[model samples]
Structures are given as C-alpha cells and as structure tokens.
Target: MHGPLNPESPVAAKVFPSPNHGERKEGRRPDMVILHYTGMASESEALQWLCNPVSQVSAHYFVFEDGRVLQLVPEARRAWHAGRSWWNGEDDTNSASIGIEIANAGHPGGLPPFPDAQIESVIALTKDIATRWRVPAERVLAHSDVAPGRKVDPGEKFPWEVLHEAGVGHWVKPASIQDGRFFSRGDRGMPVEALQAMFAMYGYGIKISGVFDEDTEKVVAAFQRHFRPERIDGVADASTIITLRDLIAKRPAPTAS
Candidate 1:
C-alpha cells in the first residue's frame, strides 16, 4: 500500500510508513498521547520491526537519539500500539491515543539516559500533536501507565520533568520520601480501598477492593514510573500517596456544557 506523502507533524522530517495499522474504531478521535521506548538494540532494527507486517506493532511517530523524527502510521489511523491497555475506563487505548516510540536501549540495555536533543524533539513533537488534537495535558502518558506490569516502555529513566517544563504533560514536585505509613501487597483495609479509589479516580485501571493485591502494586509502580520516579518499589509510601493526591488536586476541571 502507498504511504502518506507528507508527515503528520511538522517536527517529523519524513514519512516512513508502517504496514501495521488500521482504521480508528467507532470514528473515535485521538484525545490522548502515549509515549514509548523502542527498547531494541538498534534504532534501524526497531524502525524496521515497526514497519514489518509480521511484527503487528507500530506507533504514529518514532524519535531517534539525535532528535530525528519520522512518521510511521498516520495520526488518523490506529497504530497497533497500546495492546490490552486501559485508562479512565477506556480499554481501546490505541483507538483514542497517538503513540510516539522513542529509540533507546531501554532497561535491557542498562536504562541509558535520553539525550537532550532527543527529548527536545519529543517535546516539540508532543506539543504539536497535543495542540492540534486539543488533548489535555493530563492525557499525555507513558505506555507503562496504561498497561502497568504488562508494559514499561518509555521507562522511569525517561525525563518527564523536562517535558513538563516544556509545557507538555501534567507534573508537580514529588513529595519527599520519608519513613511513614505505607501499603503493600498483603495489606488490606479501608486505607487500601481509599488508595485504590484514588488511583482509579486519577484514571489508572485499579480496583477498589480494599486489598493491596498484586495488580494494585503494579498500578502504583506504574504511577511512580510516570509521576514520582525517585523510587518505584510498588509500595504506596507516604511520598507516593502525597504525590498522587497533589496530582489529583491539580487536575483540570471539566469544561462546562
């Protein structure tokens, strides 16, 4: 099939179309932006895999370490990223979001730091997409955020505070870690239920079952990966709870009809 002649965002230098995409479901327009890491040994191989039909995985855009941007799947189409994910009760994440895959060695390769140029390009690309789509800042998220335990791309090493500085995503100064009350797997009660409810209200796919289950731990870790990267032990410590509460407080109010 012929690829698009032009890139969707001006930041994208060219169109290197991927075959692994399809029509967005139910005429849904993208309202979220999901960031990811290629997590492959090389950028070329990663791009090739995304464009390969057999891989069945692709994102709307790809960013290289040197800050080069390429468009793989059109924004109007649903790229095969965000599989089996959920956010704010929306299970069809691929249908409601644009995915940007950044080339990096990732966790397997020792969690290398993202280059300044690369992060700049990401900020520019994200800003353009968010502005054009009118996506809320809170809706910009990490792949790990939607899939927890199952996916952790664009890992904690990724500089979210930098993106926030560029006015891309929502962020707040993480509450300092200190010895205090905490919740972890095996713990159960009203506090656990309230913690789960807070996570759910913040759009994380967590169950308010009053038990600190494995799933709850994963969700907490995922939240830390995005918001409070100083520590991500999956334990809902004082810092984590405070940061989550601050984020909830800072969330934008719904627009009136």
Candidate 2:
C-alpha cells in the first residue's frame, strides 16, 4: 500500500504508514476500540516493528511518550492487531475494532507509569476515533480483554478511570479490597457458572460451565487488569466480584432495533 500522508484523526500529528493491513473483513465497520502497549524498551523500536511487514502486526495509531500521535494505518482498514481474540461472541476482533498502540515499557519494564503527556495524547486520539466511529464506551478495551492469557498489553497500570472520566471508556470505582468469600481455580459449582455467565454478559469470552478452570482464572485476571488494577491475582475475591457486578449494572444499554 502507498503511504498515507494525511491522518484519519485530527489528533494524529502525521501518518507513518504500515503495510500490514487489509480491508475490514466482510465490510464490517469498526464498533470497538482496543488499546495496547508496544511493550518494548525503546519507543523507536516499537514504532518500527509495527511498520515492519515481517513483524506481522500493526495498529491504526501509535502514541509516543512525548504525546505525539501517528496514524500507522487508515481507520477504514483492518490492522493486524488483536489477533486470535474474541469479544461479545465475535472472534474476528480486528475486523470490528480500531487499535491504538501506546508506547510503554509495559510489564517487562516493571510496568512503568504512563507519562502524563502520553496519556493525554491517548485520551485525545481515542476520543477522536471513537467519536467518529460512534463506538460505545463499553467497547473500549485493553488487549487482554479480548485475548486473555495470550496477551496482556497496556497492562494493569494503565489508567482506565482517567479515560472513563474523559468519556472514552467504561469504568467504575473498584470495590474496596478486603477479606471475604472468594472463588479460585479448582472450585466448581453453580456459583462458578454464575460468575462465568456474568463475565460473558460483560463481553468477556468465557464459557458458562460450572468449573472455575484455567480459562476462567485468565479471564478474571484480564477483568482485574482493566477494572480493578489494585490486585490481579486471578482469584475472584469479594472485591473483584462486586466490581464485576457494578460494571455489568453500569454497562451501556443496547441500541434500539
């Protein structure tokens, strides 16, 4: 593909075209926003990798640590992000989501804090993309949300609440952490089934089986990473359960038919 000199979002300072993209599958329009961290020590290296066709990955936009935004692929095209992921019963996430890669050292670099400037840029870019696409607030998600266990970018340290406050994503004040009844792997019963159902209802790709299996643990961890960052032990403590319940209750209503 030829380089795109003009950016799809005004928030983007310029375009840094990447060849790793294709037409949105089945002509599906983007309805979700997926955020990721480049997870490399050097921001330049991360940017280059996204643009490298050999890497087989790319995002619609990339945000630098200094708050500069670059459009890597056009919003109308499907970038090679969110691979092998699922959400709200949709397996082809890339076809229906716009992806943003925020440059950060991520978990490998001890999960460093996102700079204030960088976060501001992320908020501005996300608002632009979501607004233009009419994407729902609840659909703004971390990479882990769609591909739990397989990927965890823009990790727990990412400030989801800040984005929510800026009207960019769904969020709720996490329930306080405390000792109480909790669920963990190896536990199995109707309660486990209920927990799985709640997660599925919230768009998590979890099966409603009565077993708290490894997949359940991973999904719970992903939920914690996005919602309750204070702790992400994979165990469903009272705090996690309550937080999940609150999120579901606050989810935006479906559009009228």
Candidate 3:
C-alpha cells in the first residue's frame, strides 16, 4: 500500500485504499467474483465502515448508488472481505475472488432496492473484471452463496437477472412457485440425498446425509437466494430442485482435448 492510488479496474476512477487487507495466499490470482451489498442504513456510512481498520473488512471495488465506482484494494491483494466463508471446498474466498460491494441497504435495513444507476455500474465493473480474469459466469457468486447460514447480504431483493441481462453473472428463469411433492425439515431418504448431492455439486456446502436437516435447509435457502429468488423459505420444493438441475445443465463444459 504505497505511492499514488492505482485503480485495479478501468471503470474505477480513483482508489480509496483500505488498510485491512493482506497479500493473497501464495500469490493466488482471482478466478471468481463475489458480490455483496452494504447492508447499512446509508451508503456513506457503509463505505466508511469498510475502510475502517476496526471493521477488518474491505472489498476490491465499491459501486455507489450514483454509479460512482471506487477501488479500495488492488486486485492482486487479498482484501479482508469474505471472512469465514467456504465455496467449492475452498475457504479463502478473499484470496480467490474479486469482491464487489454494491451500495444498498440489505436485510438489516429491510432490503431496500438497489438504484438502477448503481446496478448498471456494478454490471459494467463486473463484466470488465470477469473478462480480464476469465471468470466463468457461474463463478460470479453472491455473498450468501459462499457463506450459507453465516451471511446473507445482497439478499433476494437484489436484481441478479438484471446483472445477467447485462452479461455479468450466471442466471436463469426461476422455476415457477407451485405446490408439489416437496421435501422439508422432517423428510429423509434417497430423494433427500439426491437433493444434497445436487446442491453440493453446485458449490453449496451441504452434506448428502439422506436426512433433511437444518443445515440442508440453510443451504437450500442460500441456493434460492442466489439462483431462484422467487422464494427463499429453505424448503427443498420441486421448484428448487428443477432450478438447481437447470443451472447445472446450463453450466459450461470443460475444454478437453
């Protein structure tokens, strides 16, 4: 953290460096993008808190409501975001992903809608970073996606489809909400195991225990929050299953010879 400010992204006009960051573990280069919402009452307050040393947290970029973008950490450093998070068996999400904190009052503030100006900026920034990093669409993840049961910022209210429309992240039409033979907290058997396997395959931290438990429900809710925002009640309903399967199907194939 030395000389003049350097913007890791072309979209960022300036840098407001946060001290609460470290070198990426073993020089790990980013291959993922993690999106978050400020979740506080005011954008200014959220930005200040992120830069505060006591907060021990910062993202690589912050997208303000008026479409202003600020780079708080260099892409080569491990920003102190993504604390205690896990994804696809990797625990150091901060070191593996470019984190973007979007300005919006999240669940703590009743999940206010993100302004279009801010979302557009996010889309622009994400597309640029994703392209340069060769990040797969499916690797652009929500905060909830990496830390189920521990974090839920950038909640269901966030317009993921809008970002997808702008070619930023992976998205699909949510399975229609309907009544069907669904699994719940009390169910168990081959179906439950199958559900857990599918979720785990999709990078969710779930166990194929053949028993529908609270952890399974939380992971299901996290999956819904990121994939199927139409409903997020932690129930493994048919809609959730179909959505998960569809997402898996749409995932890109490996380029093997």
Q: Give candidates' CA RMSD values in order.
A: 1.2, 1.2, 1.5
Report the lDDT tens digits of candidate 2 across residue range 64-135. 999999999988899999999999989999999999999999989999999999999999989988888889
Model 3 ranges with Cα > 4 A deviation: 255-257
Off by over 4 Å in 1: 1-4
For model 3, residues 16-46, the per-residue Cα lDDT tens digits are 8888788888998899999999888888998
lDDT for position 46 in model 1:
95
Q: Which residue pairs in candidate 1 have backbone atoms (N, alpha carbon, C) closer than 3 angstroms, thus clashing? A: none
In candidate 2, the residue pairs with backbone N, CA or C atoms under 3 Å apart (3 or more residues apart, or in different chains) clash, namely: none
The C-alpha lDDT values of all candidates are 0.94, 0.94, 0.89
Candidate 2 TM-score over all chains jointly: 0.97
Which residue pairs show backbone clashes in model 3?
none
What C-alpha lDDT, on a 0 to 100 scale, does residue 177 get in candidate 3? 85
